[model samples]
Target: MTGGTGLFISFEGIDGSGKSTQARLLAEHLRSTGREVVLTREPGGSPGAEEIRALVLQGDPERWSAETELLLFTAARRDHLERTIRPALARGATVICDRFADSTRMYQGLSRGDLRGAVDTLHALMIGVEPDLTLLIDMDPEAALARAKARATAEERFEDFGLPLQQKMRAGFLALAAEFSGRFRIVDGNRAPEAVAQDVRAALQAQA
Candidate 1:
């Protein structure tokens, strides 16, 4: 919205909110509309970040300290931003990421303390390159957790957290939406995937 360079869009939500599905759909739509686009996800977009993603999601990051997990997230973000996100935008391509720095804040913040330092440092390090738009796909905690559990062939680190933690994570997302205001849009994630996709398209077009 601000320059001749390409745009960066990020999709964020608690697990099972269908943000990933919607991100894919949006990328497809952009391709169909004849825009150059690259579809990727946080924690594992690039090789370096993928390594960090394994550590963050593979075994039991929930079992570790909240602060440690938050650091890992930022580490992954640094790798992702350097190797993937920034480069795509510089090349004049729309980069659609399924998750981004906002997830770190919500997840870490929900763990009952601030990741303010981490968030600040990440913003400082990244400087002027950040997502142009972030769509936060919102859904009910109970339903989202239920869907996630059923869909999971096996649990990942964060996914293994208790119900109370999941609730906090869900609330954290909405809180983040409130905090960021106009930069983030909340999408109804409980509907059909196609319906959700349409909502995302409208939001992106509105911003355009």
Candidate 2:
């Protein structure tokens, strides 16, 4: 429904919710079924976007204000859509993105301030697209934060925001799922990866 005949699936949640792993698993499963699958992540999908990703993801939490971060993320998403997502979907390939605009809605829109209106306006003007299905991996903030910190990656800027931010984000994502219940599927992420994956596949099938 998003692009031609292809399916656009996005994985979203708080930091260390295991959505990325689930995204990869879903891509592999689709590919095994002989469907063309493009497994990608936001903030750094295309070359241009990848450059912006480094700028936004690898610094102190206060390095960029919420407004500036919103702009940077929107720019990255635009480039990603042009160079990666749209093309893949137009070609009838399934696109499994690690995160999408829902993230912006929470991180920039609500986390820093009440900028949901601005985020929505820019999204409509620039992106104008949403995933056909969004898989929300719901998890406890404390556990999720632990997992995120365990990664210790350079792109841990969001993770470095600590537990309170994670709690806020988890609540925001749940609210978002309700806001877009038509296309959003909530998956319990506290279980093992394989079990969670089974639920994810079930959600996709139900969508079909």
Candidate 3:
């Protein structure tokens, strides 16, 4: 959590790994437990961030260089943190974010070549915070790609890169979980939605 009173949880995984669905389920579960929950997503959580999101997601994947994209993402995230996530946390609400900095780390590092250091530096200097808990939905890249393709939209900039990239992204995410074990929980996403949801709930409960 960015604030003292709330619990900030973020979902991370390759596109189509069901992280978004699980994020929503967790929010619903938390709300049912009488907690005030705010569900949001990266690159587009706050109004200003949403505008930045279109620039990043709508254009051709090569429209911006890796470095330029990173800056845009950071700017949007700063706005998201200040305008939406932080405020919700300060009000003692549980913030369930669909994606966050972790995606940038993996996506840019994988697609843009060895930019993890830059990503880390930018995040530490500009954002300076992280989710208290991150739920990583692990799944086979093949299946995940299928899922991603089924729901294809104009925001296919990243998805257009194809399956091999997705596999690498999954490996990157797993490595990240190991690196930040204290704040990450890897849940198997190959199972039924209910089963995955139960696992997520159990992970959060165990953390609690």
> Which candidate leads in TM-score?
2
Q: Give the Cα lDDT of each candidate.
A: 0.80, 0.95, 0.91
lDDT of 2 by residue, 1-208 (tens): 5647789999999999999999999999999999999999987899999999999999898999999999999999999999999999889999999999999999999998799999999999999999999999999999999999999789999888889999999999999999999999999999999999999999999999
Candidate 1 per-residue lDDT over residues 114-201, each given as its tens digit: 7667666765665335578999999888888787778764436666775776788878888888988778899999899999999999
Span of ten consecutive residues with least summed lDDT in model 1: 121-130
Model 2 regions more than 4 Å off: none
Quote the lDDT for 62 in model 2. Answer: 90
List the candidates' TM-scores in order.
0.91, 0.99, 0.97
Model 2 lDDT-worst window of ten: 1-10
The RMSD (Cα, Å) of candidate 2 is 0.7
Model 1 — TM-score against the truth?
A: 0.91
- List the candidates ranked by lDDT, beginning with the highest: 2, 3, 1
TM-score of 2: 0.99
